[model samples]
Target: MNQPTHPAGGDVQPQDPPAAYPPYQPPAMPPRPCGIKTWQIVSITIAGAVVAIVVIIIGVIALSGSMNRVAKEAKDYYDSKAEPYTNPAERKTYTNDTISFGYPSSLQEMSLEGWNYTVRKGTVSDRRVFGDKDMNYFVVYTQIKDDGHPAGMSKLQMKSEMSSLFDQAQSSGSGLTDVLRHEQLICQKHESNDFSDLTASTGEIADGTPVVSFHYVCDSRVENEDSKIETYQSTWYDHKGRLNTITVSANAKAKNKYGRDSINIPGLTARLR
Candidate 1:
């Protein structure tokens, strides 16, 4: 159908000329995929978890094994160190005849578990004990006993007589009983029949008296070792040229996990010289 045309400048203006046709254009779209999908992300997370678990488990096992090794090594070291002290056969060289040093007839010849005795002059006899825990020895002057009666007597009989005499001497006017009790703390609970036979030195005390010292362990209840130490000094001397040893043993276990030697020795010069 034909339609009337209107002037371009008309007030109502003719309907806008038909819109000029434009070239066809495609709709906007996102870039093609270059990243992980949801499933891929989940798979990566699962793989990381498995690797982490394996590493943790391996680390724990390694640490446990290391601790066990350290414990075993420590046990072995202590066992080896305790071996020498436990063996009774290990003997220390010593003079059997204490008389050579001008000790009194009351002194005796005896052998201990860890000592070697070489008698020079006086005859030695061994004393019997209720158990092997105690070391009891008696040394008697055979030259003074006269008339063959004393000489003919058996060692056991001589020891018995000498022991009686010693008991009497200890209990007699001499203050041996008080000395023993006073020195009890030095020995803890153990007592020795002979103090002269022990090793002696000049310790820290100002007194020039000879100092005797030894090492011992408490009954198993305290520790399974000979870890205690003791020291004694000459308290009194008799007109008869006798020395009464007053002694004490000190303990370091209160401060130490194991124990320390009773004597704080600086060097062999002090001990040997």
Candidate 2:
């Protein structure tokens, strides 16, 4: 080893050369297992969504089938219950000068004077011929003389007139309030029919004379108490040019027993001469 001389010194100690070093390298990481690919994850998600959709569709189909079955069963039950009403042996004929019809023998003929609303000034005759055992249901037959009112009025005309009467009665403090719903309906005289199958429709009878129907619901003071009444009125002109009106009234409690849907308007009208 040679000694190096300093600028101001005679001899300097021998110096070691710069140390050599290896290139820099990062630390090694542990080996890892393969992870799921993005495509595989997406595919799995799509497959799950498809399965869910299929399940929902199947459930919907099953529910629809169940609902249909329940509806059919209900219809069959109602039809079976109404069989007696359709049988003539279970009913009695009620004939008067204005109209005639068959009513269930379970009901009895009642006095018209008890029905306060049926006593109109223009009415020629009024008869509350049939009522349920509890007096909750009433069928009134009425004839209106063509004094100033037009004969053979249309369904719309009848609806308007009846609505006016309702408004008047309410305004006059007749205890008729809250006219909830009112609508014109069709009246058909079927040759042979099932009461359960009869529903309120809007059209004219093809073979027989057309009849107008109106359905209304209101709150009235009956027997010194407030009550909800549902009334269905069917009107037509007789051969003598008088307006014949058949009114069916059902109180709230009686609705369950004699619902508007259960009344066979066509059957009753068919019995009218």
Candidate 3:
């Protein structure tokens, strides 16, 4: 190669600077989608939830069967250990006799001097014998026994008996003649349903005898005011299957000739439980 001559002042012009080279750069690739990883996570979460639900349902079905078995076993155990109230034959006889005549063997003797209570056999020929030609009325008394000792008589029974009396009152004319004839019609129909939803309860009687004295509502609706009346009732019972006291009363609005008067039981409070 021939050497080039330099100018007297300096070396030959510097060789042209090497042509400028472009900066080094890495190759570019297309960007990935935004949520590919997110979609994968969601799909896995949904699959896990479905599996968990199936497991829980299976567990509940199994548990239900076990619960049913437990309930049946408990019922069977209780039934097996239960005791009877009384012998079947004796019970049937007692129920029949008591319901028929208000006579319970548990009560040795019962008497209500002013109650106008009576028992008569055969059907009542005349309706409205008890002053309820339009409405049904009856009165019944049943003795409840707790150990040869009487617990208390049911006031419900008195309501039933009175209903019977009302029916008897319908047919016969009032006065001494009708009063004498009242004893024979105990269960005559003109059926009445009297209930005493206990409004107030008085404490037990002094005799340590169980007594349920309460105020009740009497639902008596007869056509004629003179014939039959209905309103509030207060009843008392002793432990001897005898009704110790009874008062049929009414509010100011129930203005019937027969108003508030305590029934005359003479000395019934003496017989407490």
Return the top candidate by lDDT.
2
**lDDT of candidate 1 over 1-273, digit per residue (tens):** 898766687755445677688767899898888988899999999999999999999999999999999999999998665423322222222222221112212222434442322323232242111111221111111111121233233334433433443454344334333333223323334344433234322232222222222223332212323444333232222112232232223334321421242223211111111
TM value for model 3: 0.23
Q: What is the lDDT of residue 268 in candidate 2?
A: 45
The CA lDDT of each predicted structure is 0.34, 0.52, 0.35
Once fitted onto the true fold, the runs of candidate 2 whose alpha carbons sit more than 4 angstroms away are: 1-89, 117-123, 146-207, 223-226, 258-260, 264-266, 269-273
1 versus 3: better TM-score goes to: 1
> For model 3, where is the 10-residue window of minimal lDDT?
98-107
How big is the positional error of residue 189 in model 3, measured in Å on the Cα after superposition? 16
* Native-referenced Cα lDDT, model 1: 0.34
lDDT of 3 by residue, 145-212 (tens): 33222344454553443344344433333421222232222212222233234233333333333333
Count of backbone clashes, every candidate in sequence: 6, 0, 29
Q: Give candidate 1 misplaced runs (Cα > 4 Å).
A: 1-32, 84-273
Report how far residue 110 has shifted in candidate 3, in Å.
Answer: 17
lDDT of 2 by residue, 32-107 (tens): 8799899999999999999999999999999999999999999999876652443323666776654557665656
lDDT-sorted candidate list, best first = 2, 3, 1
Residue runs of model 3 more than 4 Å from their true location after superposition: 1-198, 204-210, 226-268
